[model samples]
Target: MSTQARPGWMEKPRPVTQVGKAIALVVVVALVCVPFLTILSTSLASQGEVVENGGWVLWPTEPTLDAYRDILNGGIVTHALGVSIGVTAVGTTLSLLCTVFLAYALARPNVYGSKPVLLLVLFTFLFPPGMIPSFLVVKELGLLDSYASLVLPVLVNVFNLVVLRGFFQGIPEELYEAARLDGAGDLRILWTIVLPLSKAALAVVGLFYAVAYWNSWFYASLYMESDHWPLQQVLRTYVVAGEGLTDTTTGEGTVSAPQTVQMAVLVIATVPILIVYPFLQKYFTKGVLTGAIKS
Candidate 1:
């Protein structure tokens, strides 16, 4: 039997495949850039120009920072932005702490009732106790009119916990054994070894929680009063519902706020995610793939 070597061209990249991939990549990049450019242009355009050109502003005749200034000057929009930032920071920290502890415990093979606890966690994912039921629970717990409503119900996301667990499991058994040989307890091993090594997964999961908390408005609207509303709910009212805000904060009060300002509010709310996205994206593949492969 003769073993023949394959043709060089067959083994190498084809021009057609390379060109096709290049085209696809260009299309994807263009698609992503177009929306961001459009939004940014719309946000920068003058109120008169935006209104004259329908609700969308493709390009600015004259750009102005007045829209940003108006919102940032302690109006309802600014207050809502503050609320969003507060909730996002507090909620992300609390969520990461709870998820880390829970995931670490569940990752341990010898932990008592770990299997049952994990089963209970997984059960919630399958049969999520529905929105109304969860709402009632929140109400019953007297969290209906408080910030805890945002963080408590969603303290530890099951999927994130599972991902962390899988990542923790993939740490070599010998590492644990070696740590034990050096008189390290589980806490010491985890703090000194496991966590530092799992930075990618931690970043990915932390960003997921942060983004979720930042984007959340339904819960805030349901649990909070109008004055307590976050930026998204405010955006929903002003931008989506076409309700313009009054600039009461300024000494020149009762001015009809421009739609351009509303558009700028939407842009401001979205900008934090845009800024954080690039940093978080680098971890996604390695973080997700490691957990997935281990599981």
Candidate 2:
């Protein structure tokens, strides 16, 4: 076919427009990457190097793991890391289980009060419970200064529940019928059939739960004592609140630059999400689109 006779859809974008898009993309990438680079570089930079560079280093002349080593060695950050890992692990598990069960129940066609229950859940999204009220409830429940305080209050995110429910509802009804004909119970069907097929949705939802638990700081600050604070809360204390590491350190050897330690904490707080995201990213779009579209 002649080039002129090709369909409009087949035609390439104008060269100038392509150039403009490339430039725009580069700008966006740089906007994101520059700060991250600076943080990483500054974290790796020695105290003297940071001082010489006037507080921020875009590139370290000689990178060192001293900051990381110092932070991880029996300090406030170390304890906070342990707390964050524990909370994220336990919270994500409980949240995923509760969300999945609730979503599955709601997704069923003839479940008693399903509509009312779903509506009630959705209503919370529209008018979320006030923080004070939530706190009071937690306190009344005797969760204050308890790790359970962080997880229990925010156990099932309405949006994640909706996504999971939609995905469950999208499963073909014939499968349920077939399982029932084979004398399979609801739990069996879920374990042997629904869960296996819904891996994408599960992965995506699980990632969401994990990220929420990982990034959570405010709840820990409110509900837990200082000793039980998570990594993000400790990050907030030292990095965001401009609290120096003097009090945080275990009175070890010479402390690194405050900026380096701060950036190291920032990097540590950020790294888990970055490490996790790529693995689940491939499923995120597919799962969300499939659930949303099919349901």
Candidate 3:
């Protein structure tokens, strides 16, 4: 019998394989980055530069923040921004709290009706209510034209609930027994023991809820009036619908190029997610993997 000199773990990859991986990674990064860079550059470009480029600018010759200023200065974009932030913050908190409670209850052994309750939740995944039915329900509940319309309909994500329940179940049984011996109730155990240890899972789930709320537009458009629309809905109106910012014209009676303004709106809509992702990224693998494996 013969053995290679290199340890299996330390064995060098074939040069071709390494090169292929490098190329693939570069391609993936470029695919993600190029559009983002183009959008940012176009957004920062002066109106004259954008016009000279004939639509999109790979790089601005002389960048200006005028587009951003024009949009953010007491316009529809500003109002929509406030709406998005408010909805995301409030919706994430409510969803997380409800999900945590439900998951904890379902994770506990011998909890009354836990199996049936879980089945009902899983049934929703298999047979989600139709959009029309959901809309009618919301309308019947008088949530239309209200902020609750945005949050209530999708409050507890079943996948998030399952992830949290699995994570909770992965906690050692002895911990619960020990807490019981110390006279800790379920709420106390959850607060002092379970939640503290499950920070990674909670962070991942919280981020999921936050991002969903932030990116949501259709529900807002469906339920709320245009004046109450969120940033995403406003972005959809301007970018997707090709509506112009005629009201934002300068004193010289010239409006900035629609391309620059559209890109600026896109950048604004995307930036919060980018800023938030770094903080939650470290928890993603640890939390999601642990929950997935345990489940």
Candidate 4:
């Protein structure tokens, strides 16, 4: 076929179409970046600058780290930060381990009860237990008012489990047979063959668990005492509830304007995820697409 005789859809984009795409890309970037910039600028802005700008400083005339200093100076925010870190670290590790183990088991061929267990897992995903039922279960387990409550209730996410299971099942059965002939058991096969091949899925699932643990607040409010609240819940109190930081909340903090304090807290909460995302960005598309659709 002649090049000029090709269908219109096969041709390069027209100039107008290219221009429209470029404009759309810029608009999307602005929509994502502008809010973050505003937040960072407002957080760094001087009290006078923030006040003059009517609670928003898109470009601080004189940037200062006073808000961060106040938050980190032996404050409630600092403690909450510690709690969030500990919870996220411990929760992600445990959740990932449990998910990986369960997924591998379910993915194995002709495993006893694997089909029923998988069906049960999917059923839970489709019809999750309600808040009240979950609360009662937690209470029965005597996990309320404990950090374990946060981790135990959501240790294995169904979507992550399903993704991992799908990925594991996609591994070559020839590899399994070879491992077995070499005297490798399930654990050995999982460690030496399956895991090394499945790093992409693991990375994505780990990020999901980490983010979930880090950002969770509703469960904290339900199960934990105020003194044990995580950073997200504490930030909710300061920003959504419009509360001032007390002496106990932030030792030596002389309540800056709500905007500055809230923005600073937001930055602290967000920076960790931003820092970690780049490390795993390369794995996201591979993991999600392959895991979700490979089978």
Report the number of the highest-lDDT candidate: 3
| Candidate 1 lDDT over residue span 1-295, tens digit each | 1126656555556778778888999999999988877777888998778878886687898998988987888878889888899989999999888888888888888788888998898898888888898889999999877888888888888888888988888889899899999999999998999999899999999999999999998998889888888999988876777764655644464454576776788789889999999988999998888777765
Count clashes in each candidate, considering only residues at least 3 apart in sequence or on different chains. Answer: 0, 0, 0, 1
Model 1 is weakest, by summed lDDT over 10 consecutive residues, at 1-10
What TM-score, computed on C-alpha atoms, does each candidate reach?
Answer: 0.89, 0.92, 0.92, 0.92
Let me know the TM-score candidate 4 reaches against the reference structure. 0.92
Off by over 4 Å in 2: 1-9, 246-257, 290-295
Please write out the lDDT profile of model 3 over residues 110-146, one tens digit for every residue.
Answer: 6899999989998998999999999999999999999
How well does candidate 4 score on lDDT at residue 205?
97
lDDT of 1: 0.84
What is the TM-score (0 to 1) of candidate 1? 0.89
> Which 10-residue window in model 4 sums to the lowest lDDT?
248-257
The residue ranges of model 1 lying beyond 4 angstroms of the native Cα positions read 1-8, 11-24, 246-257
lDDT of 3: 0.90
As a whole number from 0 to 100, the lDDT of residue 272 in candidate 4 is 98
lDDT of each: 0.84, 0.88, 0.90, 0.89
The residue-level lDDT of candidate 3 at 223 comes to 100
